[model samples]
Target: MRRPRYYTPTEVSLHNTIDDLWVSYLGRVYNLTPLVEEYKGNILLKPIIENAGKDISHWFDPETKDIRTHIDPISRCVKYYTPRGRFVHVPPPCPRSDWVNDFGKPWWRDGRFEVGLLTAKTRWIRIINTLTSQEQMLEVCSEDTLDEILQCYLYYNSHAASYTWKYDGVNLDMSKTLSENGIPDKDEEFYQCLMDRDLYTESICLYFNDDLSEI
Candidate 1:
């Protein structure tokens, strides 16, 4: 058996189009492109389309009576649909056996279209101004690079032009990974980085003056 692949929420969000729909439910990612194409105009299609490229756990959650009632028909459809009546042989009701193991938990269990696991959640990091002690939290993903984080901060804080960032007393190297720079693991609530004086003043001046060497 092949090992299961894992994907981040951001990775799954990229497949939001009708031709490449994906959704996360109970930490599992499902690629519903084939089903979406097969049931394009069916009544069951609405919820899938509405929740495409997003998590739908709350919709069919076992504790929720409202969405559960709504999903019952979709589950029954999956259990009984026959494709074009070619009748060579009946394919299993659901593609995967685990899906068929439980009928009442959620309709997602009735569809055997899982793609991978949703492994990463958005993390918030605190970027503190060392000079003024002012702090701001920024949302980022595990796959984001230091450069991307810096760019986000710069975009949000206009005063970033006057400051640079430091992690654990060292200058934040834009080329480094967040993990490499000691950013905490997932759900940490708040990881901190210090804002320091920008040391690139001379380099910026030289670059503007057409000095490629300093760049």
Candidate 2:
């Protein structure tokens, strides 16, 4: 048997449109294009369409009443319709094969629609500046863009207080990964040193910073 391939969030974000819909559940990626086609006219299809190309594990929990309400009616309903003077029972919109197990695992175990695994773990990092003794933390993922990280930092740090703070390890390049710029993993739990460009001295410290611009 071949090992399952892993996919980054960046790759998953590319398939956000309805035509190429995909979603992740419990770290498993599923291409939902066929499901979209099958449930086109069904009311139950609305949620699936709304959350295309996103992680929907939270939406499909077995214990949640939302999933039960959305799926149970469609899964159990058998309506009779007259066609050509003959009454025929119309099957539910949800295909039997698409039914999920207790853990929300799909019944169709075929590898064809199984795209890849969500590999990166999201972590919240606490950053402290040695020079100012100021600290802050933000949630980030390994696949997050440099600009996204910076925006998060700015959003959290931006307040009534103003200080000309420079991210020591990060450079002008906003395309590189934090890991590439020397930001330690969450497990490291070590304080990183920050530098003041004007001071030319290693007086500041930060938990994580990327030096992509310097590269």
Candidate closest to the true structure, highest TM-score: 1
| Candidate 1 local lDDT, 1-215, one digit each (tens) | 95456667887888998899999877788988877776576654665676679987665444532233322264555332322221112234446662332334333554578877776665557777665566666656555666666667766555464555566566665666567777545332222333332321111110011222211
Query: What is candidate 2's local distance difference test score?
Result: 0.52
Per-model lDDT:
0.57, 0.52
TM-score on alpha carbons, each prediction = 0.42, 0.39
- Candidate 2: residue pairs that collide: 130-205, 169-210, 169-211, 170-210, 171-213, 172-213, 194-204, 194-205
TM-score of 1: 0.42
Off by over 4 Å in 2: 62-112, 122-215
lDDT, candidate 1, at 129: 67
What 10-residue stretch in candidate 2 is worst by lDDT?
81-90
